[model samples]
Target: MDTKPIAYTMSEKENPAITVHVVKKSVTPNVPSGNDSSNVTPTTPVAPTPSTPTGETIKQPAKPTIPNYAAKKGAAVYATRALYLYKNENFKNSQRLVKYPKAKRVNRPMFVVTDYARSTNGVLHYKVRDVNHGSKTAGKVGYITADSKFVVPVYYQSMPKNKKIIIINKKGVNAYKDANLTKRVKNYKKGTRLTVKKIVKHNLASRYQLSNGDYMTANKKLIVQGDYQIINY
Candidate 1:
């Protein structure tokens, strides 16, 4: 029983075996060059076109036209109401030459129209030479209103069909034997009727030739075309 102990040795073919694992890797494809139609790229967005402006342009008003019935050149006119003489047709206050007060019908201030003009406001004006005898403003030239209410033609401008005229001036008018009115013949009282032969023009003023060969002023303020019942003034 003492001889049972014995030595033992292991061989290489009797050892346990070990196992190992291996991993696989992936590869990517290269891009084509030089204007390839198959290749795509990012694009930028486009903006919309703008519309044209539609604002309207403002315009100024047209000037007024002159009337056919307006007073003519080389005619006589007289003021019926107070008025101002202007240096220019603009009729501005700064352009005023003088202020004339309203006068009596028989002694109203008179003027001889030299030209016609229109103010900026479209009002018509008469360019005239003052002919008020003995007035300090006589012979002065200026512009005045052409309104019928403020100014009017001194003469009727046409012969009456009856060929008769009557004195209407309160102070009456003088009859002159000469056209220049230098020689005084007589002074006819108001409401006196006289037959007219014809009309005569002297120094841009009109005179009526009487059948008696005497001359009287044809001023509308002093004479009327038709005869009426005489009334004592």
Candidate 2:
């Protein structure tokens, strides 16, 4: 019996050198004429053949796509107060702007400026990267009129040290996952004094970026801000 490997090749119209191995079955050795049939050893079964390939073969996985809003590390910035974000430098019209988060009524939008340019009219336009916000437009980058009245360029003067804050709000206030008051992290009882590291303002509310880097809200009217010094500019 023959004992050679069977080769599978494409038709003449297809690849000529490309060959694949299918079955490699070995022929049973011829039994001696005097040997009994019961003494013959059983042959191993052949593996099933592979299915014919149809679609274009893929060798590697597709690369993960980078999102348009992917955060790029740059000069750190902070918003002096809440402000509006526009699609272009011409914000006076309001028609040329992207929709801001209206349902949450977040008037004071805050973010870090990523890029800046001057319009023909000598207006300064800044590409601000929105920090976490309560609206669907959160984490977006857009141009805004940086007239100093709104956006203020700030730097890290020093690492914030621990400071004590008292919750004067008789009702209570909420802790948040982000500086924006969109997500509630926890709730604090009235008179609940907390030792927070830093104080900041984002979207109309004063937020505490804690020593552990967690954030919580301090409503302007509810929590007293005069006592706690704003350290991080």
Candidate 3:
């Protein structure tokens, strides 16, 4: 377990600044020849117009954050100063880049984001345009579906990827179901955890597939599935 407490040091000090004053005075020079010397006794210095200070206050901006999910080498990735990655057509071996990169690449590569994983401080990332690395922008996209209606359609570890998958949450609620949807089959336990892997929406009453294709009813009362974490033994 990477359970290390991130420590920080705090220090306080008075801010430093520069102070300046503009001295202004109205003095009548010796008008008469050698007669104003004794008469021109210096009066108390008058303070210039007392007013509020106004000008630009220069402040440094905070640095940009780098995400944790780095683009796979040769695999198209977003090349950001805050989120930069390597570029290569033939993606073969792996390598690592250090912070404040000494060598900089003038070329930029488009990136596709990986799902479910988090980067560094956990900033949500997205596909960097072209999903391919070899494409024009060196961005490449995955396979496309045949029937694209302008724009159409849109797991859990430990368990088999197949098994007619039904995703459940910490609450034992199945958000998805993948069971054979036919006529409603009954004579099962009441208030059991379930997944709706398969639902024949065409019919008024659909079948709700359970974790392993076992099921109940879509019209019946069932607990709603929500966010959950699986505790392994």
Candidate 4:
């Protein structure tokens, strides 16, 4: 056991270096859970309804009918009360041509109808000529109301039960031997009273057979049935 120090040494073949390799992993985003209410599906929309109308409807008035006994064209008409003659059927105050006053039956103002017209309000009117002899308004043409209360036929159409008839025409009527009124035999003055036996028809007109077998025109403008008292207004 001798006391001595010694050094050690190693070759490249006996020592080797070690090498390390690093690998990385990718990260993913967070997602909602299946139990969350934010994952619900959308619903469809609805449409609104329309409103109804509530107003009332209006109607127009109907026209009135004329009476069969009413005076017609070419007939004489006289006013029972004061009446105004109008330039047109409208009968406005501004269109008034003259005012006719009611008078005694024998001298009452008269008019001869030429035609008929209806107002916008369905009132009836007569187109006529003022035929009162010697009147300042004579021969004037105009329109007047056809209201029976204000105006009426100058003569009567129906026969009276007593068979009495009077001449009403301003001019006298003539008696004939035949119903045709061809042979004029005698003339009866206005206001003359006569009795009729019967009525005869010829040429679309009527004639009255006198008690003496004479025939006279039964024209409504010429004669009236019954005895009427003299009236003054």
RMSD of each: 21.6, 23.0, 30.5, 19.5
lDDT of 2 by residue, 45-158 (tens): 999998867996868975544333322234333444445666666665563445433222123344566766556676666777776557666787777655555444332222
Where does candidate 4 have its weakest 10-residue lDDT segment? 1-10
Write one digit per residue (lDDT tens) for candidate 1, span 60-101: 886655576666788888888999999989888999998999
Count of steric clashes across candidates, in order: 0, 1, 12, 0
> TM-score rank, highest first?
1, 4, 2, 3
The candidate with the higher lDDT, 2 or 3, is: 2
Candidate 4, residue 113: lDDT:
85
lDDT of 2 at 68: 34
lDDT by residue for model 3 (37-96), tens: 765767799889876568857679855443333332232232324332322212222421
Reference-based lDDT, each prediction: 0.82, 0.56, 0.33, 0.78
TM-score of 1: 0.57
Distance from true location, Cα of 150 in model 3, Å: 34
- State TM-scores per candidate: 0.57, 0.34, 0.17, 0.57
Which numbered prediction scores highest in lDDT against the true structure?
Answer: 1
lDDT of 3 at 227: 28
